[model samples]
Structure formats: structure tokens, C-alpha cells
Target chain A: MAEKRKIDARGSFCPGPLMELIAGIKAANVGDELEVLSTDRGSAADIPEWIKKVGHELLTTTEENGVWHITVRKTK
Target chain B: MKIVIVGGGMGGTILGNNLARRLHHELRTGKVRITMLSASDRHMYQPGLLYVAVGSMMPDELYRDQAGLLEPGIVFHVDPVENFMLDKRQVKTKSGAVHDYDVLVIATGSRAVMDSIPGLAENAETFYTEESAVRMLKRLRGFQGGRVVITVGVPHKCPMAPLEITFMLHDFFKERGIGDKVQLHYTYPIGRVHSLENVAKWAAPEFDRLGITYETLFNMKEVDGKTKTLTSEEGSSCKFDLLIAIPAHKGMEVVEKNGLGQNGWIPTNRTRLNMEGQENVFVLGDTTNLPISKAGSTAHFEAEALGENIAAMVKVGSPVRDYDGKVFCFIEAGKDRATYAMFNYTTPPDPKAPTRAVHWFKVAYNKLYWASARGLL
Candidate 1:
């Protein structure tokens, strides 16, 4: 039951947001949720795909204030 | 103050964004006008193009529209540059449009030369263009099994590209269960696999691990597609089923015609990226005569310093900013792992510096450096 971590990755190009999410996942414990904030349109699609492929759990994905906030939980 | 940057490649865009973010306030005083010119609507992440050609990344994923990445208040010119009037401080576009600038930056990058080898153009496929990358990717995917030769042409971008191709070929063959059938060979004009030792050391073991053949100090002279042979300058020959040739590099036609390129590249200071003769003009990225690999990371790092320098020059009319000739690269060796290197030409490292640390640092930089360039850091 740790506090969720947030990373701002707006204006970053591809592999940037995913890399930050991976880094964040690495620093968190199992069941820890992480939120990635990005402006890149591709991230909305790419992050969920990466999360599924890597065995991470997607918590929620929402767009607000001209940015997409993707939350993923460390599954393993 | 008016800032005009020509050529919307890696150098121009990075410098444009960096300047816009830093000098947004100065422009409110009517002291800054930054303009970027290029014909293409898409921003090609060129470094990933090589992987795209190898089927690692999809074509659409490697390219992004210029409109989305650019910031507000910066004018994007969707026209090709027809000519440059240096004395008049103007650039003429293809449609006869003229742009006047107080400070002009030339970031038109270099191009691959295919005419050097006679049969290369006819037989081999280059990964420079998106179309060519798609073609190469198709060829790689359909390749059943064959003797493939990967050779580095002279003065190519990302000097380690050929090595990376060879390493990935090994991985590709392994994954396809044809590792024993496809004989992979890597050839370089220089004795070392890479121009820099930081990358060459990691590549040496990977080559050994993957059992890829390598020939050094051999300059490729001709490719006889009929006979499936590659002839070298020393009159030696190697046979292959497929040829991946990295051709020689040449500056853009504009740089050559304007007398900017003397030794085949625009002469600029090693650190400042300022043109050797013109006071108002600056150049950076792979288009200059600096003794460094013409890679995106170099352009990215140089852009930060160059952009700041341009802003300072426009605001205070001074030239005081400095640049550290630092470049970081990540060599994807396949199998979900990479090798990275961070090289700084200033204060050459002692020969005793741990090569493994340099290698690991390079691997770790793959993610960190990519993020930093995207403005996430």
C-alpha cells in the first residue's frame, strides 16, 4: 500500500515516456501504482501496449488538461 | 532580433525548440524572431531509421509530423531552399520566396553517396530513406538464408551503424533459426570495428559471441552482382548472397555550391560550431567538419549549447557561449540488451579508463539519452 509515484513526460518523443514508465516501475514495489503524464499522442496507445507486453498492470488512462495520464501497477 | 535556421533536420529542430523554450520571454520585447525552413511535413527520427530498415521499428513509428513537435511563435517554412545570398543575408526558396535574417544557422545534414561503388546502387539497398528502409525491411524479412556481407562506406553517419547491422544480423539469424545457414560478414576500411574505442571493445566480444566474420582495413571497391562478389582496393574479394553497404557521405548541394564546404564539409570551430569565415552564420550536427561521429546524440548535445549561443548572440550581440564536444550512443546488440558509450573529445581519457564501465555507461545511456533529447529530462 505505498503511495503512487508520478512522472511528467510531456513534450517527449517516443521511447521517452515508455522509458520513464519502465524506470518508475523499476523503482516501485509490487502492487505499487505509477502514473505517467505525457503530451505525445502516440503515448496514449503505446503505453498500454507496452504495459500488457511486459506483464505490468494498467490501472487507468485518462486525458485531462491537454495531457494524457496513464497509470500502471507493478505486477511482479 | 531575428533568428533564421535553415534545414529542419535534427540540428535545426532541436536548436529551434531549445531556443524557443529558453528565450520565450525575450521575444515579447520584439527582440527575437526564429524561423525554420524545410519541405518535409514529417520529422524522421533518423537514428531509428537503421533499425526500421532491419524490421525492428515500424515505418510509421519512426516518423512524426513536424507540426506537432514544433512550438508556437516559430514559423515553419514548407519549401525547399533554392539558393542562398550570403552577402545580402537572405535565403531564396524554390518558389522564389526570400527570407531575411540577422542570424542564419545552416543545419542541412549530409547525404549518403552511392556513386562511389559501381554495382552498389544496382545490387545493394540503402537504409537512408523511409522508402528504402521499407524496402530493406521487406528484403530482410523475406530472406530465407544466405551469406550476407555488411560493409561500412567512408564517412557515413553514426560510424557504428555497420557494426550494429552486423550484430543485429547475428541476432536476426538466431531468432529465425537460420544462424547456421546465413554467413554474416562485417568489413571496415579502418582496422577497428568502430571509429571510437568505447564502442569497438563491446563489439569485439559480441562479434566473437555471435561468430560473425570481420575484415578490417579493407576499402570496398566494387560489387559484382552477377558473380555475387565484393572486390576490395587491395584486389581481394569476398563472396556474399546479400550486400549491406554503407556508402560514403557528401554534404548537401547547397553547402557545396555556396563555397561553405572546403574539405567536403562546412568548416566550423570544433566547439563553438561557428562558421570559419562568416560572423553571422553558425553550423552544427553532421554537416560540419568536426572530427566526430555524425550521429543524433551529437546533434542533440550540440544543439543545447548552440541554441544558447544563438540566443546570447541575438540578445546581447556577443559570442561567449562554449560547447563541449560530447556525444553518447547506444549500440543495440540485440537479445533485448544494448551497449552504450559517452565520449568527450575534450581532455582525452587515460588509456587506463575501464572499458567495461564505458560500455555499461553506454548501455545505460540508451534510455537516459533518448529521454533527454525528447526534452523529458
Candidate 2:
């Protein structure tokens, strides 16, 4: 079973959410799911860009009540 | 491992504190040591100088004791590096002490050199330093009002400073009841009002709405102090009543003297943040030849990457992460409104309309910076 990890980076700025996502991805096993909660609007677009560049699988990205939920699956 | 950090500005301080907290166990067990060498004992929140220029923040409020800001596991020294013997993995300080290190991190920040431009030092009002910010405040207070031209130079720190100062000046003069007399004319070296296309798109319309005229591709050439005239390399001139220049910046002189790089920028691997050709020597902040915006936020993000990597290297024999060239900067639009720009190496920024909420956040950040330096944020 692929475990899931959640990183809460709400109220943090741009790179904070990104850094937390990276840290979460590093700790997750390959094929595990990772979700990042970020309040930074910039990171909503950026985290997906990072996932694309790094060859990861982006699962879903949604926003509700000013918080962004960016999910990805570890590939390597 | 002896880790010697040269330069104790925003980048170095944040990196030092981050490592100290992460590698505390190794530090106490005598497996690792972190020492910071700096020019001064005081750390200045340099971004505050813009507010100081506009009389919102005092100079004293911008500084904290450098030693007090450090973590317990780190050793702090007020000795500036005089020579860099990179081959020997050692740095000699001004106090005649040579320290060798297993790892070296150079965070020697850049400086705004007014003298780099002919007649600019004597003729223009600037706010890059403490003395100059106060002087600019005085200059703004006594201005009788005319064509006040704000010219920007390349390689300067804080990408948004030139624009922010221009916006603040508009609000300042307007609050003083001289808004009609003050004609704010802004000039940029690039073809657009800003380098980033979206930021330029947003700012150009804002300038128009504020009745602030601007000229793009107006690269500053020389200022004739006697005639109060400013000339650009593009065969243009401005006869201005007052000239405010965001002067061209270069990394610290020590970096150039040691043959690290030309114009004081060390050749660095953009992702690894290591000085080119050296595995153990790293460079960050304004010292790197990275094409990213040289802002405090750049250093902060770089510090986080370095902290994670260095800690992993110490604990597990390898680094785990790479910097993604992340940078975030708040832009103050006039009348208590602000916007921000956030981007990395791969993605360009998309800025939006300014809002009062963002402006107040920036104001709050002015106080929050110290906690950030302490690695709490």
C-alpha cells in the first residue's frame, strides 16, 4: 500500500510551502502520495511547475477558502 | 568538520543559525563547528532603509546585535575576511588570523556603488545605506517640487526598490500638499518599466494612473552636476530638478581582489550553490553569478536549501536537496497598497493588482525579520 503524507504550510510565504513539499517528498517512499497545503498563491502554480520539471506525477491541485491543496506522487 | 562562513549578512546569518539548530548534536559532540566572520557586530535589516528614506522607520530600529542573533552552537566573530586562499581551504581575516575549514560558504553581499557612475555620487540622492537614506529624507523634505527623475541602474539589490521608492515619493509629496508640483518621472535601463513582463504590465498602468511619466531603455550614462542634467546611453537627456539614482551594485571588493570572480560575483552552480570548480566552497546571496533577483528573500530560500543539504551531508554522508531558485519579494505600491512577485529559475512571476492587505503584511514583516534571522520562521 502507498502511504500518504501531508505537509501543512499555511500562512507561510512562497518558498516555505515549496520547501515543505520538497521535504515531504524526500521522506516519502517511491509511489507514495504527498499533499501540500499552502496559503501562498504563487506556490499554487509553482509546486506543479516543480513537479513537472523534476519528473514527478502531479495528482491534483485545488484551492478552497484561500488555502491551496497541491498533491503529487513520488516517482523516483 | 570546521565550517567557516565569510560574511554575516542576511544570507550568512540565516545559514549559520539554520545549521546550528540542525547540527546541534554534532556540534556538542565535537564532530562539527561553525564560525562566522563578519565586518561588523551589528546586523542591519537592509530592506528597512527604504522605509527610513521615507521617514517611516528609524535607523536604530533596523539593526540587531549580530552575536545576539546567533544560535548557541555557532561561534561568531567580527573579523572580516581579507584574503581567500581557496586552494588551501582557508581564509585570512583583517585581524591577521588564518582559519582553515572543511567547508566554506561565502555570503558576502553586494553594495550599491554611487561612484561607479560619473557625477552620480555628487549629484543624485540615494537610499542604499544609512547615511544616504537620512540624506535622501532631508533632500525630499526640502524639495520645492519640479521634475523629480528616478533613474535605475543594473545589478542593483532589491529588484523592486527603484519602483517602491518612486511610489513612496509620490505619496510623500502628495501628503505634503505638493502632489501637483512634483512630476515623478521614472527611468529604467531595460525596454520595459520592469524586467519581468507581468510586473511591467502591472506597473506601467499604475504609473499612468498616478500620472507618473516614465522612459524605458534609458540606461544611465553620466550626470552633469553643474547643469543638473542626466544623460542616458541611448542618446537621451533629462534636465531634472532632483535626481534619485538606484546605483549599480557589485559584490564585495574582497571577492574580486581574491580572484574569485569579475565584478565580485563568484561563478556558482545555480542548483548546487557551490563555487565553480570547488566542491566544498559554496556561494550564495549577492555574491553568486546566479541570474535571480538579489533580494533578502533569495538568501532566505538559499539558506533553507543549504541548511537541509549541509545537515544531511553531516548526518548521512550526502546532501539530499537542491535549491530551485525560489524568490519572493513584496512590492509597495503607493497609498498603502502592495503586491508581490514570486518565481524560480524555471518560472517567471505573474504579479497582480496591489492591495492594502499585502502592504500591511510587508509592514508586519519589518518586525518579523529578526525572528526569521534567528531561524524561528
Candidate 3:
């Protein structure tokens, strides 16, 4: 079964959001979806790069109200 | 699980406080224990040393009681680690006590080795330590006017110290009304003013505008006090009236003695931040052999990542997250202007023009660093 988790790292900086996503993925089963919310501009750009390199699937990255929402799915 | 942390510098102290907060329930229930072993009872805000040298700040403001910084759940001790027993998962301290841990963290910071070059310790005025900063301040106060040469060494603790001290000194002499009488010359071991390409590009013009001369590719091989000369490996010699040095750094003595890594830097997995081949032993701060700049911000970020992962490991039986070589450094550009560099493993820092607002933020951060060490920031 595919599950979904949201990591609230809205006020955190780069690597903080990415770390939260990693933690979410660690606790999720394969095919689980994780979304990270970060206000850090750096993290919004960096989180996708991390997922791409790690062989995960990046679904979408959007920015609204000075916040970035990044969604990814566990591949392995 | 017994979590034993070695070296109560910024990394260890922050990690201890972070875990204490994260694992408060486990700590209260005796399910997990966090113990911190440090050499000194005091914590020094190292960045203030540069300000101390320039007579802008006092030495007393740089330190705090290390024990007071920790949370109530942590077991803090003033015992320095003398030997590492990694195989047995135990460490012997200077006071002849042995501590065993399921997980160990090494955060023993690096030190400036002035004596590495001949006559360096005797001739050059460096501001790396509290004593050295005070001595450098005295040297600058007594100095009337002459050719002042600043030489930098590789692998130092603070990445921006060389440039920061130069700009601060330029202002220092101007305030003393000796700006015209003194000629400030800066030298770097590398072919640029700074190791970072963008920073060098930005700083080179600023150095010119300030009328401070600089020489790149000036690697200091030896310093002769009698001749008042500094010789570089590339066959360059410079005469100096007063010499200021940014000495090379090496890992702590205990690290070198334990054969952890070459020159006291432990071989660490860049992402996992663990000692190579030892999953239970983690290395942070200046102790890790990571190629990133060994700045306090580096340690702080690493401590945050490690704190999260360690706490998760205890709770979930698996560690989560990796440190992505993130380091943020504030560069003081003198004249009440400052800038910052933020970068990580995949990206390089693009520092824009200097700003007074950023400088004030840096000033504010100097005071707020205590909260940072307590894992509150």
C-alpha cells in the first residue's frame, strides 16, 4: 500500500528540509509519498537535487506565500 | 543505550543539549543516557578572537560555563579523553576513568600550530587563541608605524580569519592616525587572496581600494627573526617590520596519538559523518577529515544533523538523514560592512556585495551564539 507523509520544515533552512524528507522516507514503506514544506529558498531548490541523485522520484515543487512545497516518492 | 560524547567543544556541547531535548522522555525513564566528557569547564566563542585582536571586543565576553550550557538530562564531566579504545568501545580519560558507549562522538577541535615554521612562534603575532589575541592587541597598540606583513598558512580553523583580520587592522591603524605611516601587505599561500574563487575576486578589489598591498603564491617556508625576513617555498623573500601569521592547524593531540586519522583528522564518511568502517563512532567539527571548511558553523550544522539522527536511532532503531556538507560563514569586510557565504556539497557560495545590515546581523549573532550552543537557535 502506498502511504503519504508531510514533513513540516517550513521555518527551517537548507538540509533541514531535506533531512526531514529523509526521515519521512525512512519511516515510510516503498512507494510511499513524502512532501516537504520549507520556507528556505535554498532548500526548495536543493531538496529535488537530493532526490534526483538518490534515485527517488520527484513529483512536483511549488512555491506560494514564501513557502516551498516539495513532493517525492520512495523508489528504493 | 549509553551515548558517550568526547570533546565538549561546539559540536559535542550542541549535540549533547540537542539529544537531551529530543530524548527527554527516554532520558527521564533511564532508557537512554547521554554523557559529555570535555577537557575544560568553559566554552569559548572562537570568532570573537578576531574582534579581540582588533580591540573591538573584550576577552571576558568570549567564554561561558560549559556545564551551564547543557540541559538537565545530560551527564557532564570535566575529563579529557586520553586514549581511544574503539574496538572495546571505551575511552580512557586523563583523570584515569574509563567510559564505555554504544555510540561515541569525537568533536575535539583543531589547533593552530605556530611552531611548524621556524621562528614563526617567536616572530609572528597570531590571534587564534585568547592569549594570542590579547598579545596581538598589545603588539598592535605598541606598534608606532612600519611595514606590516600578514602571512597565512593552509588548513587553518577559521576560513575568513586571514581576510577579516586584514580589513580590521586596516581600520585599526586608520583609527590610530598611523594609516599613512604604516604599509599593510597581505600574503597568501595560494594564488589568490582567498581559497574560494568568488571570494578572492570580490576581496581583491576591496584590498586595492583600501590601499592594502597583497601577494599571492607566497607560501611561507621559514621565518628568520634575526633578519626579520619571511622566505617562501617559491623562492620569494619579504622583509617585515611586524609580522602577523595565520598558522596551519592540525587535529587534537589525543586524536593523532590514537591513530584515528592522519594529522588528527579522522577518516569519515562525508554524508553519514561516521568514522570510516565504524558505524557507532561519529566524527564532527574539526576532527573529521571532511574537505569542507572547519568552521564553527560547519560543526553547528553537523551537530544538528547528528543530533536528529542519533535521537532517531535510539527511538526507531535506524538512523535517518545525511549531512550535505552545508557550511555558512560570515565574512567581515571592514568599514562596518559584512557578507556571508552559504554552500553545500553540490553548490558553491555566491556572495554578493557587502552590506552594513549584514554586518549588524553578524554582530547580533556574536551575542546569540550562546543560545545556538544550547541548541535553542
Candidate 4:
């Protein structure tokens, strides 16, 4: 079973949300899923790019009510 | 049409990207071209330097490749400008390349001259550059306890930086458990602590709460690194264990060498931002000798208007838009909260209460700024 964690980075800006996601990914085990909530519009694109760069798998990303929820799985 | 932009700093890059997007149709049809000449390949997010100094951010995160931040249609040249042959309507590069232009935009921005104040180059730490910010961070980490003095040289960019440093220092030292052992001092050349009256008033309570001493009308005349003292033109002196001074700022040397500047700053039309006496030339950002705060936000606002004006000039030989000198500045009160001020040439900014929300907004802006440079925002 894959464990899951959530990072509430909502109301944080750019690198802020990105930094939080990195930390979240670091603490999670391999194959664990992490979700990040961010109000910054840039996160919708930046988070996916970062996950790809770090060899993480992006599960899904959804935006609703002016917030972005990005989900990723740790690969290594 | 060949539009050549000199200097690839924030203002120059943003304007180039915007212009390239606006002229995309003409570019695809081979009727227009945009070129940007940058001295170096790095584009620095200058506002983040403060965070680097406070140990909240890394220096590497504040810079990016200049070429990568431009739109697809714009050409990027990694060449240092040596001279502006305004008479010939061309620019000469250090590599012996001469580029003619139908339109030229000067966005070389400003540079900090440490030599202006004696001993400052040898003693003090400044946060204007990545190297200096890193050095300041190292110095702060080793700070035991003493008087910390932060002063601003007049007419510098980001007038609120010294204040931000003061507030951040207060929070930093408090967190380190030496808050009482260190005395924080701030000095300004003007009579008021801030250029904007309302901002000064809004900061009063915060300054008082943080126990940061504010000194006004103190123009730094010289510094004695050996003695660890700073002397002002008014015959006042303050001794410090560590000194953080914002060095004197001036326009790029190439501009002064070409007789394009007055007192080392390019003079431009207030509303249109066109260089004085040069019909096809434009100036924006800290390079211009405008009586406004030399902030990135000011440049951002000026770029919005200048881009429209340039497009109109290329099409009809006249500008359809007018700039009102609007500028916004976000002041970081501490680690978690920030405040903002918005104003223009004729009106003072309405005071906004400090909040964590504004701080988050500033954080968001830092990320969005890259997108903006690429013309995606």
C-alpha cells in the first residue's frame, strides 16, 4: 500500500510552494504520494517541471477556487 | 525594423519579451526584429538579495540565464556595450561589432559605486549583489553582539531595503537569543525615515516595537574601517561593530562616457520615457533620472507603458499611452509578515495594514517574475 502525505502550501508564493514540495518529497518513502496546495498560479507549471527534473512521478494536478493541488509520487 | 535593446536586466528583458510578443506578426512576416545586448548571461532577481542576506534564501536561486527569459522571436547577444554612437544611431560593442538600430531602448540600470565613500569598499558589507549578500550572511552568522548600523546612500534603488534589513535583523537577532545585546541603528539622508510620508508614519510603531533607532538627515560622507566609525556631512558620527551600507548608485559607465547622462543618469521625458533630444531612443528603470523610487516595481510599471508606446511609435510615429509614474513597494516587516504601498507621481500611496497575506503575495511575485520575463504572464 502507498502512503500519502499532504503539504498545505496555500497562500505561499513561487519557490515557497516548490520548496515545501521538495521537503515533503524528501520525507516521504519511495512510492509514497504527496500533494501540495498552492494559491500561486506559477506553481501549476513550476511544480510539474521540478518533479520531472528530480525524477519524481506527477500523479495529478487540479485547480479549483483559486488554488492549485499538485500530487506527486517519490520514485527514489 | 530593427529594435536594439541594451542591457538585459529585469527592465530590459521584460520590455524585450513584451515587444517581441506584441510584434510577433511582423516578426513572422520578416518586417520586424528585436535584439537585446547583455553584458553577461545572468539575470538576477535583485529583490531576493535581502533574503539571501538574512539566510532565508540561497544566492543560486536568485539568478537565471538571460537568454532563456526572452520570448522566441527576440535575439539575445552576450556582448558588453562599449559606447553609444548616438549621432550615428548605432551602438559599438567591445568585440568591435557595430549594430544599427531603427529604435533603441537603454535599460542598463544602475550600479553601486563603493569608492564614493572612503573606507566603505574595504570595511562594510552590502546586499546589492549576490557576492555581497553571501558575505553579509557569513558575517551575520558570526555576529556575537555589538552595534549594527545600516545606512542608505541617497538616490539609491529600493529605498525600503535598509528598513527591511533593520526589521529582518531585529527578528534574526531575537531568534538567535542576542536581541538585547545588539543595538540596531538606521540612518537616512532625508529628514524623514522614509521618502513617503505615510510609509514613515506606518513604520514608526514597528520601528519602536523592534527597538531600532532611526536617524534622519544623516548623509554618509566617509567611513573609517580601521576605526569602525561612519561620519556624516552633518558632523555626526556613529561607531559600529558591523556596518551594512548601501553604496552610492550611478548609471552605467557607457552612458556617461557617451555624454548621454546628466550627473551619471540618463534624462528622459517624464510621461513618454523617451531619451531627451533623441527621437528614436527610449529609457526605462533605474537608468532614468526620474524623481521616483528606483525599484523593480517602478520599472515593471514603466515597461508596461513603454511597451505600448514603442508599438504605437513603430506603427504611427507617435505614442498613444502616457505613464503616470505608478510604483508599488512591498516592505517585509519581519520573517512572516509584509506590507505594501501603491502610489503615483501626483498622489501618495494609501497606507495598507501589514499582513501575512501580503507576504505570501510577495513570495508569489518572486515566482511569477520569471514567467513575466518570458512574456508568459
Q: Model 3 misses residue B178 by how many Å?
A: 0.8
Clashes of 4: 1
Fraction of real interface contacts that model 4 preserves: 0.00
Off by over 4 Å in 4: A1-76
Better of 1 and 4 by lDDT: 4
Quote the true-contact fraction of every model: 0.00, 0.00, 0.00, 0.00
In order, the Cα lDDT scores of the candidates are 0.73, 0.87, 0.86, 0.81
Better of 2 and 4 by lDDT: 2
Tens-place lDDT per residue, model 2, B1-377, is: 99999998999999999999999999999999999999999999999999999899999999999999999978888999999998888999999999999999999999998886799999999999999999999999999899999998766789899889999999999999999999999997655687666888899988999999999757687999999999975578998999999988888999999999867878888789999899999998989866667899999999999988988989998989989889999999985999999988657688888999999999999999999999999
Write down the C-alpha DockQ for each prediction. Answer: 0.01, 0.02, 0.02, 0.01
Could you tell me the lDDT of residue B95 within candidate 1? 80
Worst 10 residues of 3 chain B by lDDT: B188-197
Runs of candidate 3 with Cα error greater than 4 angstroms are A1-76
Q: For model 1, what is the error of residue B149's alpha carbon versus the real structure, in angstroms, after optimal superposition? A: 0.6
- TM-score per model over all chains: 0.77, 0.83, 0.83, 0.82
Q: Candidate 3, DockQ to 2 decimals? A: 0.02
lDDT of 2 at B309: 91
Q: Which residue ranges in model 2 land beyond 4 Å of their true spot?
A: A1-76
- Shift of residue B22 alpha carbon in model 4, Å: 0.9
DockQ of 2: 0.02
